[model samples]
Each structure stands twice: as structure tokens, then as C-alpha cells.
Target: MIPDADPSADQAPALAEQAPLTERGARTRARILAAAREVFEERGYPETRVAHITRHARVAYGSFYTYFPSKEAVFLEVADLLFQTMIQLDLVPSDGYEPATLIRRANRAYYASYRRNAKMMAIIEQVATFNVAFQEMRRKHRAGAVARSAKAIERWQRAGLVDTALDAEMAARALAAMVDHSLYLWFVQGDDVPDTERLLDTLDTLTLRALGLRP
Candidate 1:
């Protein structure tokens, strides 16, 4: 008799478990995931299937099931990986750097990452609109980033570097919304892409001024 399939395998592995994959297992998983991203980007989440991913990956159909129990599991894994990469972006200042400079650097880095993953991001947004699981995943990702930003804003306020009157959490959420919405419009909606340097400069200036930072 055939063994029963793992029930938990239908869910993406927890973050801590993701790292302990054996070398061969990791390679196979990566192949499946890369295939998933490409298929999703080209055909979108609604049209994608496990067979498409397996064919694109050039792995046996059974191999795909061994790594990811379903297309949804793999898709969530891909989104989580992308979110983790973005979360690791840093704005920490060096010894002589000013806050404004650090903010500019952070924005530049963020935009660069966004550009690299623009297609996947567009897919994520589209899927999240109607998929409850994907929507919750998106919400959790944004909330974590906003919470970090709010804490940073609070620190800046205590140091007298930011406006004392602004509510830290609200300010953080607003700024995050501004960046996310602008990127979505420009990158995902086929709006004309602005010059990189000018765009960064404008964003940095607006962010600093919003926090009541003076030149």
C-alpha cells in the first residue's frame, strides 16, 4: 500500500526550517521555486499549475511534490523569500554619516531591490487581492516593516532629529504607504519609469521634510 502524504507539506516550511535543507534538497527546491516564479510571472498565479512548474523546472512530476506539496505552498515560499530579502535592508548610519544620508541610502537600496523583483511583486499584489492567505501574508509583511520604521522614528524623535509632534506609528505607516504605492504605480502599472537619481533625491527630500528635518 502507498504511504499517506504529509498533511503539513501543503504549507510552506517555517522560516527556521528553511535553512536546514540538505545541499541536494536545497538545489532541487531552488529549481522548483525558480520555475514557479517564472511561470507565475508569465502566466500569473490564477493560471499557473504544478505541471507547468515541474515542466519548466525539468524535474520529474513526483520530484515537485517531494519538495512542495502544492503550487500554493511554493508560491507562498517564494513570496516569503522575497519579503525576507527586503526586511534585511539596512539604514544604519556609519560613524560620520548623517541621518538624511542614511535615509537616502536606504531608499536607494529599497528601490533597487524592488526593481529586481518587480514582476514577482506585481504577481503577489494581484494574487493578494482575492486570496485570503496571500492577503494575510502581505499584511503581516507590511506590518513588520512599519513597526520597525515606527521604532526608528521614535528613536529619532528622542534624539531630537525628527518632529516631536508627529505620531511615530502614523508617520511610519504613511511613509511606507507612500513608497509602496508609488512603486506599485510606476513599476507594476506600466507608468513611465523616472530617472533613478532624481527619483531617489525626490523621495529622500520629501521623507526628511515630512519628518521636519531642516537642511
Candidate 2:
């Protein structure tokens, strides 16, 4: 004979009440998030509203509140998702690659990711200008990349692959800024696209020269 199951034992914690949303509920939440992304990309943060997102999502007016608390909440979620996607980009080169080749590969990966998310990136930048929270988010994202690059630079310096006098953190920040602003200008600011091969080559050469990897 089987013993009776304990209802209390199966009960989830109060804090995680929403953790087990049903498949249908999950789909609705995803729809709302996708709609929020679309509205933010098209109308921007200032111009977008919960109504707009709900309409685009095709859910009942009340259904939105069931998942998100407010417009800012949903927008932040969308921004977080975009940043997570970007952070997953394959920027690290494999071992045994030359420094120039590694830099080139990293640049190409960043540019490709930026191109794919250009519109959302523009929206995130715009929001970051006036939103303290978003500004912090952007700063943290950049800091993570900079920290990784600095460590890589330090390793190169230890190996006598780059200039020992170069400050790793500062150099990483500067190189990251260079790549970011270059992509921003070309993709966000509507600058004419330069020859991709030439652009990558120039950037690679400049990076290598800066690191004293090449004369």
C-alpha cells in the first residue's frame, strides 16, 4: 500500500510562486516580452506604453499585469535579454592563434552581433542616456568585457607578446571604446558601410600596433 502524499511538501515557496508558470502562461509572457521589444525598437522607450505593448502582444489588457508590473519593468526585462544575447557572442579566439588573427576574429564577431541587434542597441543607448538604471546596466556590461580583455592583455604581456609598459585595463577600455564607437557610427548613425575586409584589416593592424605586437 502507498502512503498519502503530503500537500505541504509539494508546495513551492511563496517567493517563487511564479516560477512554475504553465506552458500557456509562459507563452503569454514570451509574447508580451516580444511585443515589448518590438514596441521599444519601433517607438522607443519614451513613446512606448503598456497599451502599445499589450496591443502588439494581442493579449487582454489585464493579461499584461499578470506577468509584468509596469512598462519600465517589461522594458528592463527586454533590455536585459538583449544584453544577455550580446554577451553570449563568441568573441574569444581559440588557442594557438596569432594576436592579430584573434583581434580580427573578435572584431568580426562583435560587428556581426551588432548588425543583428542594431535597432535594439540604438534603443538601449537612447535609454541609457537618461535612465540611471540602464546606464548602470550598460556600464556593467562594458566593464565585464573590459575586465576580460584586460586579463587577456596581461597574459600577452607576461608572454612578451605585447608592450610591458601598456596598462592593461586602460588599453582594454580604449580598444573596447574604439570598436564600440566604430560600430555605433556605421550601424546606428547611418554612416555608409565601408569595405568590410578593409575595415577589419585596418582595425586589426591598429590594435596589433597599439599592443606592440607588430612594428
Cα RMSD to the true fold for all candidates = 9.1, 10.9
Instruction: Note the clash tally of each candidate.
Output: 0, 0
- Give candidate 1's error at residue 182 in angstroms: 0.8
User: Measured by TM-score, how close is model 2 to the native structure?
Assistant: 0.85
Q: Write the per-residue lDDT of candidate 2 for residues 152-182, one digit (tens) a residue.
A: 7887888898788999889888887877888
Residue 47, candidate 1: Cα error in Å is: 1.2
Whole-model Cα lDDT of every candidate shown, in order: 0.76, 0.75
Q: Report the error of model 1 at residue 103, Å.
A: 1.0
- Give RMSD (Å) of candidate 2 vs. truth: 10.9
Could you give candidate 1's per-residue lDDT for residues 113-189 as a string of tens digits?
Answer: 89889999999988888878777777777776776677667767888988789998898888878877777888899
